[model samples]
Target: MIPKYNLVLCTLLALALAACQTPWVRDAQPRAGDAAPAVAEHPTATPEPETKTTPPTPAAPEARIEPAPPPDLWTRLRAGFTLPTRLDDRRVQLHLQWFKRHPHYLSRVVERAEPYLPWILDRIEQAGVPTEIALLPIVESGFNPFAYSHGRAAGLWQFIPATGRRFGLEQNWWYDGRRDWVAATDAALAYLQANHARFDGDWLLSLAAYNAGEGNVLKAQRRNRARNRATDFWSLDLPRETEKYVPKLLALREVFTHPADYGLELPPLDPDQRLELVETGGQLDLALAAELAGLPLETLYRLNPGFNRWATPPDGPHRLVLPHGASARFSQALAELPEAQRVQWQRHRVAAGDTLIGLASQYHTTVALLQEVNQLRDHRIRQGDHLLIPTARESLERYSLSAGQRKLALQNRKRAGNRQVHVVRAGDSFWDLARRYKVGVRELAGWNSMAPTDTLRVGQKLVVWTQTPAAANPNIALQRVRYRVRQGDSLARISQRFKVSIRDLEQWNDLDRRRYLQPGQVLTLYVDVTRQAGNG
Candidate 1:
């Protein structure tokens, strides 16, 4: 369809053409009312019926229009790839062989990369960088936006907290911008570009610096200089991970650039049909946003993985990514919604005897959910204070899992949610039970109405909640303090002094009440200091 301005321009052009096609008569100078050159008017043509009985069919229009084909993201990525034709080609082949041995790994990573690969390629193209850079996430995070490593690297780029913040990605209680596709991509590319320049345009060295820090790369380079050795990426002594990191990216690029050669199929995707960004002016619950957009909450979370909770941050940078074709519907629906109604909200003034648990119980939510939504570090709330409460979605399982998540979740899920009772056997400690059941010690204690430090009796039936982790109470310190029995100290006197029960002391020390106390006899007393007075 023609745009309005274009349609108007077309109309003007047609009118100009019609004016050009007008029949004209030559002007003649009239001496005295000489017969003014009369312009000949063309008469409309009417075809006379022929003697033949058959009538002719009408001709087709002068112009035939067909809809343009949608741009294919995979095709663009293939074309835009920074093809390796030098020594790196051998490295790429090496990676290809490694991939051939472990083909499923590549397939899984590719499946995970499907959502963001197109967008990453587009960003690389826009930045005029080597499209090979697009494959970096495969090595760093497998393109899993929620991917976090034990090394503390996170998101698709696998940026650690310091590096993430260095690139201006937000890290906070409610949100982490490292998981934000848009912000993280921009920051990552900017860092890549800056480092690429820092290493004097050697992308290999730059990539190494990205994997290891610039300081490490510089140290490697300095060592090479001192040894009078070649300063190429291969020659430098770098971290084991960084050494293979750049090669992995290049190898992945080769496979992606020629998927068929590697016996792999690149997933098909439309550039315009990929995920789209929607601006949220303020805090909006993802559950409500999903409902309005007709999306599963899991899908919303996948698209907006930066959100650490059920909703966006109370502060700004409020945005949500929606699947393609849903943005318009969501935007329209959102426009119609009053700001107050965007997410289900309840405003309650803190009354006497109000606690986070009590308020959460009254509102049908969890203390953790309330704390997360309101950025509360503790359950403490004052009287006459107002609290914004968010209604929680029943479960995260209601939403679909991303390709990577499904695999990991399936593996871990095998041990979770069995809901079986464990009859305590002799020598079974809470830690032992927790390790056996793959549950937390504190959770085991909570389920069985005990404590992590509590002694377990033989043949006791313990209820286990496998699906949930023990919610840690940061304010409560479960510490075992050493106490020595004085000459006058009795079990009751020791218990009174430490605010611990005599029964607990007997269990902890494995002593009978009949045993006499001796001077300087050491005993372990588990005390929750926070529950006592004069504690912070």
Candidate 2:
């Protein structure tokens, strides 16, 4: 287990991939355990009777182990193997060549998957599916539940929004069931099963259908049938990606089934690195959950990757995963905590000009979370809308970063070593600073060792990192000049003329999306007279 520490606020201390769960204040964090005097059940032992004639001594009671393996994930996975080992196909061999060259990627993915592999493989076994299906995540998302594709598929299984909803995976602002391993795995298996049956029990065809929807597969199959061609997966014309998807899985299966053949070494699984599921009585903040579990909040977030917010969802599945070591203590402490105190909240009333993004910044939370907690269907909220915002909690050590993310962070630091300085003005805020620099609010906060919700005084200087220096950046020469509305005036035209984003124009002038512009009406415009090449 990773050692826990009472951490301090610093640039390096951050929950990677987590935007809102950043540390607030964590000085002298409380420990999970407290001792009390034990009460005596019995004062003394009774004398034994000498009635039995030479009664044999009873054997020591054998330690009872709950019916499970020794918590070895690798052994468990291998034992549940149900997939065929035959692999002489041309496509599979080609994929093996690529994988052999990039063995490090495989090792890193396997390591990241350690926290959930045992549970996932167990479920696949109970479903009577081949253990090879367990490696499907490697092909889809590298076992990262937060993985999102440019194609709009998300989660480990990479379910698209429509497909996820069809499988009963909720996609509300609060939670994305697509990222829930328990839900997504089940849904993926069900879809695969349906596809298998539809394709007459052909596993290869089923995998192809999983990549490209079953409808698409059916359409291709129909074309093959019309032409009286062979109806097998390889014979039919399919999407290019689907054609390789099955081969990728087969290649992974070959390596896992015979690692030594490819000269790759698989590490022994840690028995203590086991996941434990706990029933949260209700929605609970993960900061408190980590404290009670005697572990880092990042570990909790990793175990419960499906939880998008700092806390569990308000509706159902009031459960979260913890390290097996800390599960008992966390569950016990949670039971004793008051329901109202599970998450510290502040009531807010929306003003006439209040925006969700602005309000979220003021509250040190995300706009999506605000929408989720209030169950708002859209961004539109009327004035005086009562909002309950979760207050930030102090944190200790940051969640461990994935190897890839760590490398990227290092690369960014090296690139951002030379930065531009931005001074806070009369109308400056965290949101404005990020927008003006084209960086996220969290990135700005981390750069300065401050939280997004921290207050900034006028004349406070912030170090802003850019690809180019401030003197060379054309945007730095932006001048706030007034432009009069003409007969053919439009926000898009004005934005193009000034080389500014339409969103920035709307924000700067506070104009509604469909508001009309009258001729001769004056508008504020920030333009750059000095144009520079290769500037963002």
Candidate 3:
């Protein structure tokens, strides 16, 4: 109803007032679900700009980690060395000085011990003994498994026959467990631990006992206790060998602990580089084992010196040590091979005079074994019966490291003096033989590769090294000759033909009087040419 210009100006003023109230009403309004506020809202008010909400970022996953490998064998050994390394004692100093003077001695010993030290260290750790005990082999045998002492101690642990037997080490024609490093190590460690317990945790006394026997150590302790003296290892009146033995071990600990101080460069032995013990399943030929392991025969022999023949024992030990890489191959090959094919067999036809005893002797087997193989109820066998005999795959001579071969090599070795072969008689003794040969008993035994304590058989042959030749001696003019046995030949006939006694014939040829000689068997005879001339 107002004029046009006046109406437009009034309408603009109203619109501006409405716009100013709109924001106030919208801000004053209650949020959704909140209690209502006392405020009036403009119906056409613009809504607030829609707010954008961002999602949280996911957390990163943790990184994976790996554990480090174990340290080298020497480092592990050093870490576990719990023995007293102080060298204040004069005895320990003396040994230390000697070791320092011979630096190469440790070098050679370490070289020999490389293949065995890791295992030795592991055993010592498991037994909860001082790691220094790992070095005992160096003191005992310079790590030589084949070492045999004049005192009848043998192998790396230097166990005498009696001690070895007591420790369950079997000694037989086929095997000597004393020379087995693995078995000997376990036995030696067990022995040391037993002595340790016996000596009231005195490691020094325990080590002394290991060298000089527990009885000797106990006897020394008893004497000391009676005297009201200290029963310590240093205070005891031990044997000269044992007195130095404990100190020697301590000195070794010092050298090994601080090799740089002694100017010794220890050999690097990887902790992972090790030998693995594998089950052989049963008796196996050494040659076949070597072939299966992809190793040389000599190498196999070196690793397993316990075997004395071309094959393992007929009885069971049923285990072998092989290189870590070769163990799997050997085990797989052995498993694939048939049991019957393990050993070579021969079919023997029983003749009229063929007794099990005679056949066993001829085939170098036992009567019990012959009976078992032939499935005989007893030793009785009928003529024309076939028997399966186990024989060596290779010639006996091929096994050069065998006991017999070693003896033959020793007998044939050239020496400084004239070699004389002596044929033993029924009443012969080492003392009597040494006196007759004008040689020291030790010298006579050494020439024949025998110990003085070894028993002598009536037909056993001994080698004597004399300064004078037998031919030059007027009392006995002897000549060495080889005689081949013919069919139907007897020791009596050979003795009669050679103008030698029957006892002399058996002794020269290493024969049994009860057994008949095989045809074409060679016999070594030392003929008395002077007696022959007299008979002529």
Strongest candidate by lDDT? 3
lDDT by residue (316-410, candidate 2, tens digit) is: 56888777778889888987888888988988987655667657755656777789889998777667779888864543123233222322343
Ranking by TM-score: 3, 2, 1
Among residues 3 or more apart in sequence or in different chains, the pairs in candidate 3 whose N, CA or C atoms overlap within 3 Å are none
The TM-score of candidate 2 is 0.63
C-alpha root-mean-square deviation, candidate 1: 15.4
lDDT for each residue of candidate 3 in 299-408, tens digit (9 for 90 to 100)? 77778878887788888577888889889999899989999978888999986545676577577667777777778887667678899988777887777776666777
Per-candidate clashes come to: 0, 0, 0
lDDT of 3: 0.79
TM-score, one value per model: 0.62, 0.63, 0.77
Give the per-residue Cα lDDT of candidate 2 at 135: 91
Taken over the whole model, the C-alpha lDDT of each candidate is 0.71, 0.72, 0.79
Candidate 2 Cα outliers beyond 4 Å, as residue runs:
1-86, 347-357, 364-388, 395-536
What is model 2's C-alpha RMSD? 21.7
* Tens digits of lDDT, candidate 1, 1-536: 65687667666665654554333411223434458566543232223368646434333333446989866776677677663444345665677798878777888888887777777787899999888888888888877887766456778998888899999999875678888877899999999889989998888888888889999999999999999999988789898888778777877776777777777876666556678888888888777888889987777888778876556776757778887789999988888889877657778898654567557656645677778877789766767888888754434444334222333353343344644455444466988777866777766665543447656763345666565333342212445466666788789987777676787667565566885776766665666566655522
What TM-score does candidate 3 get on C-alpha atoms? 0.77
Predicted model with the maximum TM-score: 3
